[model samples]
Target: MNCGCDEQRRVTVSRRRLLAAGAAGAFAGLAGSQLDTQLAFAADPAYSGDVLVLLSLRGGFDGLSAVVPAGDPAYYAARPTIAVPKAQLIGGGTFFGLHPALAPLLPYWTSGKLAAVHAVGQPAPNRSHFAAMEELERAAPGTSLRTGWLNRMAGSLGADDPFDAVAMGTARPARVLDGPAPYLGLTSIDAFTLTGDDAVKPVAATMAALYQGAPPALARTAGQLTGALARAKALRSAGYTPANGAAYPSTELGAALRDVARLIKTGAGLMTATVDSGDWDMHENLGPAQPGRRMHDQLAQLAAALAAFATDLGPDGLNRVTLVTISEFGRRVAQNGSGGLDHGYGNAMFVLGGGVRGGRVYGSWPGLTAAQLRDGDLAVTTDYRAVIGEILRARCRVGDLAPVFPGVTASSLGLVATR
Candidate 1:
């Protein structure tokens, strides 16, 4: 996976550590804040590309339950107890069908704004959550590069502001946004501020004066922090109301996505944003396709949040945004004795945006027959990186993807239209 790039030549800094140092003394209250998400800004304000939203479905997600292969008899045989009955599926084609739980997104799927890619995974099989996720985010399997692919993409886009790349939602660390690219992490928009910064104390003002005469590196870091705080303040002042009557659910995912919509609509120079949703590791009692069941409830929540996001953006706003879903890995082809699944190989990805060629599943489906299974799991026919690389090239205008995903070429699935 060596791309002839020198990792030593690229100077990097942890934005989190930089913030802690910049406000070391004055902002003692900073420790109490829940700063989990990160945001970085681009230097080129005129840069025109889709706002790439990456939704990481953490834990081992069961793609088989979500996107059922009803046409394949082998699929039913493998998971007879847990398989989604063909009669309950929606958005059906000759081969694939959407889980009924994903009904919220069926309109988007039918309207050519949503699509799914099956049989997608890494170059090699990795069932360990930590190792697989680390590799998934790093995205350069055989290379010495430690930077996340999103960070590389930001660097390629000439991102200089601390708000260009954002990791929005829950306090979970977004390993995908790690690298040299200047980014800011916070729980939400309103929460992004220097603690105790009021009219009386004025912590931000004090820090600005303190670093005014500091060295270039120190001063630049301070400036980025202060500048980001100012922008966040402005956004807070301008109260938001979701457009198109889109009602976001009362959940963490819903709140995170609502904020993402706010940032995009505010015309913030948001090039890429990452959000995470966990608890997909259903090892037992996965239940049935009913509302109270585990799989159904999770998918319903996911579809609701995503549907609200798209609705709030509307057609015009959505035209400039592209959202994709990925997980560390997928569940096994066969359900276990407990009626749940274990970590497996191949997975499925959902691509949603105005530019997406929707209404059908796209991928080279290696049949689910026992002979085709990779060690009792669905064999990966298309690399996940290639799926993303195609989107990067077509929608984001990234000419060369080798730096971001070494030794991988974009899939020619025509999944997205050229920007």
Candidate 2:
């Protein structure tokens, strides 16, 4: 049942470890009643930025499959068996066409809310998934800083609350949110609660009283837990139904996105959130562009969930939010004997939101001809950090990019409008 990738195997073990740690903190008993400083609440009312959602596509995602280069004859030559036929593509120009499985998102594409940036990746290629992912989250290359880019971004924006930077969906701590900034991790809104916290047991109240006269740090941590528990309780009590008749799929991505929308709509002072989706390591039988197949089904699920998220948010909510997708790396250009691709370099990124200048592909197209390929992989013309840096400045109102991505300049792709 494993993906046969070193990182995939490591991630499974890591998730287990994170789940144990998260459970002990999020579901604390009266004996050790501590929320582990993972939950805090301080909102910078002056802070104004789009609620950035970072979706990590774990395992090497084949960007060539999602954003097909139909106009490139070499693309078909590379993968004749798995290439998305040009006629079945949708919402693309002469050079690029989205995979047919992405039909759900075509409306957003056509309406200028969704866009893709091709040939984007790390500054230099590192094929090892673990190393690449670590570097990807760290983002500050050629520096000894261990802090994650999102944490730096949050710190730069004056984020002091646990709600400010959240790692939603599975209760695992996001590496991208690693640093001094306080953040929360939860599976969903309703599930975010202290263990045995009821009127009968009153664990939360007891914990609050226990830390009443404690020192500043201890008392502050206790207070944060109580406040966050109270807020989560209120949300659970009120309950939620997707707005605008938006029906999110029963999948993890759908639920995670739904909760993200809920947080935004309820004004949770959320600055950034991170979510992960795995199972993209297609080393065999990636399949053709047809329903029930691996690639097609995965893309369809992604499209459907994203479509639901946007529909639920509507225009006003989307205007204040932006979501971007990233992966450690992409797949090789040519299909293998098993009809799959191996690890690769350059990939594609999807940016979706109200401020986005969508309906077109962005980024320099390094032709797929053998001579243009970088070691049989797509050549990276756009740095992934630069793309995000641009979004941070233009849409998120981040005045300085040096703190988050040291030595990197924000891209001038005009991918999004400044707030």
Candidate 3:
């Protein structure tokens, strides 16, 4: 009756404010765009590695329900009401099986393109949504650095292009992509255009002329804005079509992933991209592994969109792409009274890419018995940062993981291969 996670979720920048910033080409927005303008002045090193896509599963994800531990009898004992029947599982060997809801991803699982790491979470768990997510993005604990880990990673890699660090699916960047590294946020590719600019009234040109003889700071800002507008126009003129017969679901996530694919194909100098999927905090009515239920429908939607994205990318596109999922924490090991789950720790992460060693779950499995649980939650056997560190080093070609993860060491889970 006395659960600890009762704080209100954090409110970020409003969508209207984000749009206004984009339209006004403010200093921060200009800095994000200046990456493009600054390219002409510096010999930009070409990034010939995998594009890392960070999919944030907002709301505490119930990894236990999704990645069932049929091998352990204690699992069913803990969540009798909401437990996914072992017989109804989709992909698994003898000990573990995935919930039937994720059927769409089974093909990728079978083809060795998808995998999961169980019992993974932060070094320390925080139940509050805002606090946990902030820690997750910041990644560094007990350190003075306040920049997001993704930003640090991008900065370390010498990325300066506006497209290098992208926060797609919304009008503003996610906290994970926050910091000094240049990045842009947009709901979609076409929605990135400047507002109130037409043939008769050229806002970009007008601003350029106004700031021609201005101070250095004002002039640089103007140049960055105009330059970004020109590049955006070129991209719009080129247009895009999803290759390999891939059809996005027209949902927020689908649209966002579509644009990410578009930018990658366009060679927009993208290094890291972030997307968000929420509503995983199912504290009630998380029905069985059947259609029309809460968790079932959510997972299906997620699987469908992800499968489509991978299909559209095809083998070639995926070969240069690495997609990973992360959440603040997992659900309680034992289901709460309302046939739902409460905030806990040690969630599961999915890794999908051409170089992934899939068709099997990775990580040391801490059993579901009460003794094995960590204060009523799944005990974390793997640090989430290490999992990402592995992907960064193997697929993204990040030279050093220390700057991005601080004191954390990269995992040798063989989740991805060094090409």
Query: Could you tell me the lDDT of residue 255 within candidate 2?
Result: 77
Give candidate 3's whole-model lDDT: 0.76
The positional error of residue 335 in candidate 3, measured at the CA in angstroms, is 1.2
Worst 10 residues of 3 by lDDT: 34-43
RMSD of each: 7.0, 5.8, 6.5
lDDT of 3 by residue, 184-246 (tens): 554444545444567987766776787788877556655665665576678779998888888
TM-score of each: 0.91, 0.90, 0.88
- Cα lDDT of model 1 by residue, 1-419, tens digit: 21323331111223344466553311111111211234556767676899899988889888989999999999999887888999999996889999999999999999999999999998999999999999999999878999889988988998887453332222224678777776655546766655467799887788789889898877776676677778888988997899999999986678778988998887767888777788898898898899999999999999999999999999998999999999999999998999999999999999999999999999999998889999999999999999999999999989999999999999999999998
Local accuracy of candidate 2 as per-residue lDDT tens digits, 1-419: 32434332111112233235432223221100111112222377555689888888889889999999999999999998999999999985899999999999999999999999999999999999899999999999899999989888888887886353333323435568778776766556766655455689887788778778888766776666677668878988989998999999887778778878887777767788777777888999999999999999999999999999999999999998899999999999999999889999999999999999999999999999999999999999999999999999998878999999999999999999999
Query: Measured by TM-score, how close is model 2 to the native structure?
Result: 0.90
How much lDDT does each candidate structure score? 0.81, 0.80, 0.76
Q: Point out the higher-scoring one by TM-score: 1 or 3.
A: 1
RMSD of candidate 2 to the truth, in angstroms, is 5.8
Per-residue error for 20 in candidate 3, Å, reads 11
Instruction: Choose 2 or 3, whichever is better by TM-score.
Output: 2
What's the ranking of the predictions by TM-score, best on top? 1, 2, 3
